[model samples]
Target: MSKEMLNALDALEAEKGVSKEIVIEALEAALVSAYKRHYGQAQNVEVEFNQKKGDIHVYSVKEVTEEVMDSQLEVSLKDALLLNPAYEIGDKIRFEVTPKDFGRIAAQTAKQVILQRVREAERNIIYNEFSQYEKDIMQGIVERQDSRYIYVNLGKIEAVLSKQDQMPNEFYQPHDRIKVYVSRVENTSKGPQVFVSRSHPDLLRRLFEQEVPEVYDGTVEIVSIAREAGDRSKVAVRSNDPNVDPVGTCVGPKGSRVQAIVNELKGENMDIVEWDEDPAIFIANSLNPAEAVDVIFDLDNPKACTVVVPDYQLSLAIGKRGQNARLAAKLTGFKIDIKSETDMEEFYAKLEEGAYIDAADEVETLDEAVSESDLTADEYENVAIEAAEDEATAAEEVAEANEATADQTEE
Candidate 1:
């Protein structure tokens, strides 16, 4: 029995990662509970296990009284003195109460206590193991599927890949290994329930971190990422080193690095663009696969922009259903309106024509001049020339006066 108890403690220490002392303490508690169950539940019983001696002892504490009413709690002074010569009235004493039936009860209680303790210890182990992997990418095998979710084995624990967290049109088969992002860990009555996702934007970032050495080493930085998941995604990258190309490094030799990531994503297309400090250039790069002719900023309403692409690439710039253009607007935090070359030319022409007509109407309204009143035909030419020169000199003097006034105002 002593050997079996030592073995249980050793197993608890090794398997459940509990200390030997803790297991021994749990054993003592179980024995005390067993003593109470077999004897009287109200008995003030204590059980002690000496680790070195392999001895187990049970004692019941009773208060000394002149007259004992309840024998379980109080002992008469005369009866206590019979058991112990030092016993005196009003003095508490402990009497041995190791029941013969206690060994059988202890065995049953030990099983229940060990099972409960081991289960709680296992839960703690699972929590600790997965907490370290939070916000990381993990690979798991598809174990089975219910109507609304799929269960995956992540080697240490099972994770749920819910239907909502899955990418559209992506499917998982039994025993298939898939990569997922651990989104959340929940503690429940049963155990730790981990929720994983494949559609999250961070999944892409983490994948790049895994595949791109520059990212891990701090030579290259991923600025932002946006995704539509299973269809297309965009990432903005920048390089700290002048010589090292961030895009080229992420793309790798013959597109090896990016291809690996793409294959893992189940052929989702990726556009790796170089991030720029200038918003105009950044937005232009963000709408790749179609060149941006120009970016027009509307400062009065700061959140709007107009982008022009070539007429033929208009559909491409806007994507099949404006996915590219919409993502660009979101990525740059602007209301993007895409136009083709033809649309831009027509708009500019209308503005120029309006300005020309305004100028013509202004000229038509100006009728009389001081030079016209001072003329004889040949003397008119000379008079007109002199008046023009005089007017130029007067205009120059007025401009000087305005500059002096402006300077004074500034001071």
Candidate 2:
């Protein structure tokens, strides 16, 4: 042991978080093992470590007895008394048996033990540091990609973005920077494995927090999210402060804030809707880009709703392949059934036109809302068909005007 050894321990403590005291203790134990291996005998041994002098001493313990039966473990009374006059029987004594040539072996053993402990200490530090970040968001650069996974370098570690967690139709290249959600962290024997996801719903929520200060500070709360990664998503937001408009806050000035998030997500369209306690109002708002005339909740089954839109807007409300309606249902936790006001003609002309499968839509005459009994089935059919034609013509004009407005906005 020397000052150089102490200096190295201090460096380990500062740089690797390895305690010098712990390394000293481990080194003391290793010295005892080396003593036993070198001497090739069974004897009780004790190690003394002096921190101030950076010194290690090995001692053999022996019981003081008047007659020594085992010379290796028992000291003769004469010998004990030579060192100490008051030495008595059964008193354990320490004998300095430090090997003269042990310095070289001790130094080698200490180096190996300290290095092993430093690695373990560093691993524990990293595991604890990253565990706090589980389920949080991080920005990382694409390191590489293979058929099975994409490796993203997240500052301290390489995070795994598995194929299943990747966004639909999204591509990545080397050095591309993207934000990811830290979904899981596993402390494996090899190392800490971090799993990240780009398509997680919370990724969108976290992006909202990053871009929208009101959301990050808790003035606006995200109620729900439904996402079709790389295509579209819907978010329901509510304001904690009544004065602040939650939807407007998320959208920002001239849509700059939301557009930034959209660009980050590779142009994934997002719809921000004001959250409402009343299911009727929320369900209506969730159907964005489509005007809802009325939303009626099923009294028996609250998870179901009937939404009515103009005949021409029905296609927009249903979306291509009913994507809009499906995503709205997921966002609001309700199963939605959509109907058009002018679909009564299709219902009456099922033999010729396609059948109107929406059972909730029972269209009535234009004069007044007709009950089931006011007119026979045939009379109701005749009145509904006439009213449907008039509604259809008016809906077409509205649809055309909406298209013109959208085109102008795009320009």
Candidate 3:
């Protein structure tokens, strides 16, 4: 049994990568409990194992004292001196108490400990391996599905695809292979849990990296992505090289690269646009298939803007149910209020009308004040001149503001 136990330890270390010393230490502790339980001995005892011989020993430990208060825990100095002359007061001594049937208990304890260690070692290995893949992409096979999650086999372990992470338009079947983004990895009491996603915006970015050589090699950088999974997605890319066009590189020759990604996503539409440093230009580019006539920013809020498109392209810029405008806002990190050219014209017209009404009211108020004051002719004339000057200044300011708006729109 001793030789067999040593061989088992060697096999465990070689096969499972579990340290033999760790198993031996655990086995020794378990044997101590087994000794006390089986023999009904409540004495202070310890267990030791011989690494070379694979022999297990149990010993009763006692404190050497002048007067032994508890026989189970202490030994008298006179009795200890008989066994060993060097025994002194306050010293600890061990007496071998190996039982006749201890080998059987030790064998059982060793088996249980080895099995537990093997399981623990396997869990650690798996956790360490999968933790590195967090926030990355991997191809997995669909094994099965339930109401809550879809199980995907990723080489050694199974990953979970939750309901929210699954694409609505795609139906997963058993044994179907798919690419997934590793959103999170957690080490639980049971084992390692990997949460994967098909709808994450980063998944689109990774797909671009895989399909576009310029993106992978860092010549073209993906600025941002806005995706409505299973429907449509927009990607903004910028190029470091002056000669390379970021948009054309991502689109590929004859749109083959983007088409491959779209097919992989189950007919999801992709709009790849060039990223510009200017927020206005980038926002304009983000609204593809619909050209922006002007981008007017909100002075009070830097992240808010109004994108004015052609009157005919209002529906296209807003998309079906405002999806296009919503995605452009997300990609540009701006709060977008899309307007048509006609809308802007109507807005300006209302402003001018309001100003004119205010001027007329001021004139009426001046006339009322003059009639009530009974001022001399010269004083009244001076008051009239001041009012005219104020009106002229207000009109000039309004015109200048209008001119600035037009100049910005043209640029």
What C-alpha lDDT do the candidate models reach, one value each? 0.83, 0.86, 0.92
Estimate the Cα RMSD of every predicted model relative to the unseen true structure: 8.7, 11.2, 1.4
Positional deviation of 95 in candidate 3, in angstroms? 0.9
| Candidate of highest lDDT | 3
Give the lDDT of residue 60 in candidate 1.
87
What does candidate 2's lDDT look like per residue over 23-117, in tens digits? 88898888889889988857889888788888888899999988889988999999999999999998999988988887888888898899789
Against the hidden reference, what TM-scores do the models get? 0.78, 0.74, 0.97
Candidate 3, 258-348: lDDT as tens digits: 9999999999999988899999999999999899999989999999999998899999999988899999989999999999888898898
Q: After superposition, which runs of candidate 1 have C-alpha atoms over 4 Å from their true positions?
A: 63-71, 74-92, 300-303, 344-411
Worst lDDT run of 10 residues, candidate 2, spans 351-360
Question: After best superposition, candidate 1 residue 18: deviation in angstroms?
Answer: 1.6
Per model, state how many residue pairs clash.
0, 0, 0
The collision pairs in model 1 are none
Sliding window of 10 residues with minimal summed lDDT for model 1: 363-372
Superposed model 3: Cα runs more than 4 Å off: none
Sort the predicted structures by TM-score, highest score first: 3, 1, 2
Most accurate candidate by TM-score? 3
